[model samples]
Structures are given as C-alpha cells and as structure tokens.
Target: MLGRVLEEIEVNVLASQAWELYRTLQLAKFIGEELPNVIEKIDVIQGDGGVGTILNIIFPPGTPGFSSYKEKFTKVDDKKRVKETEVVEGGYLDFGFSLFRVRLEIIEKGEESCITGSTIEYEVKEDAAAATNANASSMVSIQPLVMIMEAASNYLMNLKNNKNKM
Candidate 1:
C-alpha cells in the first residue's frame, strides 16, 4: 500500500532567511553547529548542494534503529522554497520499505514568520505490510529533524534579538 504523510510547523523567522536555510547548503552548517545533539553531521557524498545532491544524514551514536541513510535531492526550488529528497539507500529501506521520499517546503506567512511543511511518501512491500503497519506510527520519525529546525530558528531569532539590543 502507498502511504503519505504531511506536516507543517511555523517558525519565528523571516521567509527569506528560512528559504535560504532550506534551499542551500547552509542548513548543513547550521545543523552541525547548532544541533550537534540531534544530527551528528551532514556529509555531502556527491554533487553540489542542489538537485541531484546526495547527503549522508548521520544520527548520534545512540540513535535508535540505524545510524544514517543516503538521500538524493530530487528537486530544489529557491523561488518557492521547496526541497524534495528521496531515500536512495539505507534507513527506511533498511527497515524494508519499498520506496520512501520526503519533501520540505517553507511558506512565507509574513515578514517575520514562515511555515515549514514536510511531506513523506512511502510504498510498502506487500510481504512487509503487516509488520510495517503495526509499527508504522513510530517507524518514520521526523522528530529529530523538526527539533533541529526549531533550534535553528530559535538560534537565528536570538541572534537578531541580541543584535537589536546592541
């Protein structure tokens, strides 16, 4: 069966700033510097940080299930602040998923606020459907990513707030 999930979160940051973080390779830098607890490191395996870019998203040592996965950037749209990534190997596939993909979009709501939306698409192998469905709720967890984004946003906001104080 095919499964699709969509979730959105609002952050207190300018749309342009949020778009830049989402569209370019700066996000890797942010995560590495600001969220070392959640994301160990984001290594670019191939291509530039754009369409066709491959990334190894490594989790911390004690992270559950698997350590990392290779994801290919399928689409990158700066104008719309959208990024699409597909799991090429490891991670979810290691858990027996036939196919899996994720899309992230930053929608501008105002001058200082934006909504980050995530869409997950997956297809399960018929044989693994039963087991997959049973543990599905906890299977595909984006909690870490969400946390990282929130922390990054807060960090940027703090920088702005602190600068204003000066």
Candidate 2:
C-alpha cells in the first residue's frame, strides 16, 4: 500500500450539542504562530439536491478551497439513537499546504439538540511528492469534528425542543 494509497478515517464522540465549540477547536491547531504553517479560516458551505453540499475551508495567507458532496440526513434506523448528517469534503489548499478527502458526520440524540456524537474520516489518497505534511490525524485529534457534529445535531434537536416548550 506504500506509494499506492492508504485511507484512514477516525471516529469519536463529542460533547452533547456543541457545534460552535467544535469550530473553535478546529481552528485552534492553525493559530498561535506555531507549527509548519497556519490556518486562517474555514468557510463551510454545504447544500446539494438535499444530498449535495459545499464546504469552503480557508487558510491563512489567503489559501481557500471549495468542496462538494452528497449527504444523507437521517438515522441509522427507524428507532434511531440519534439524528445525523454526513458530508464528504475534499480538495487542495495551496498545492502542498493541504490535500485531503474527508467524510464528516454529526449526530444528536434528539430532533433539536446541540450535539451529541460525531465522526471524521480523512485521508490523503494521493499526496504529491512535494507535500511533506503527513496526515497526523486520529479520532483523538479530530475531536473537534465530532464535537461540531454533536453540536449541529443538538442544535437541531434543541430547536425542536424549544418549539415544544413554546
């Protein structure tokens, strides 16, 4: 598999109903003037035939990308443990700065809640020879992705919960 391709995606559980928190964590790695480079911003735009979506993650110095994917917003079954949404985001950031294909899913226990569960699958199926930044990804490091998923899901659930309250 060396030279051909090695695909890896890690999954984990995030705090219940917390998307903004996850977003903050996602950007933390790119801040503080440390590491090989930095990440400035991430603009995630996702929407497609109720299945397709777009996510634009921007980096420092003006490197940005637009990713599109098909998503299924539902549960694993009828008696779903949670509500969920999944999207695949893939693209390049400044040639060698970044290149990856990621599948992200967020889940919540209820209809309108902040967040509860999440998963992130990222892999550089094809990294250029010049690209040196290895994909140091794990279900641990990508806790933020999961965290956001939980939050988003919970947010939806909470919205429903609030309506019931009203």
Top-scoring candidate (lDDT): 1
Model 1 lDDT tens row, 100-158? 88888999898788898878888877667676565644577667767766776787678
> Candidate 1: global Cα-lDDT?
0.82
What TM-score, to 2 decimals, does candidate 1 have? 0.87
For each candidate, give its TM-score against the true structure: 0.87, 0.35
Write the residue-wise lDDT of candidate 2 on 35-130 in tens digits.
222334434354421223334444455433332223333232222333334333333332232323333223453543322333433333345322
The runs of at least 3 residues in candidate 1 whose Cα sits more than 4 Å from the true structure, single-residue gaps closed, are 131-134, 162-166
lDDT score, residue 107, model 1? 92
Please give the distance, in angstroms, between residue 68's alpha carbon in candidate 1 and its true position after superposition: 1.3
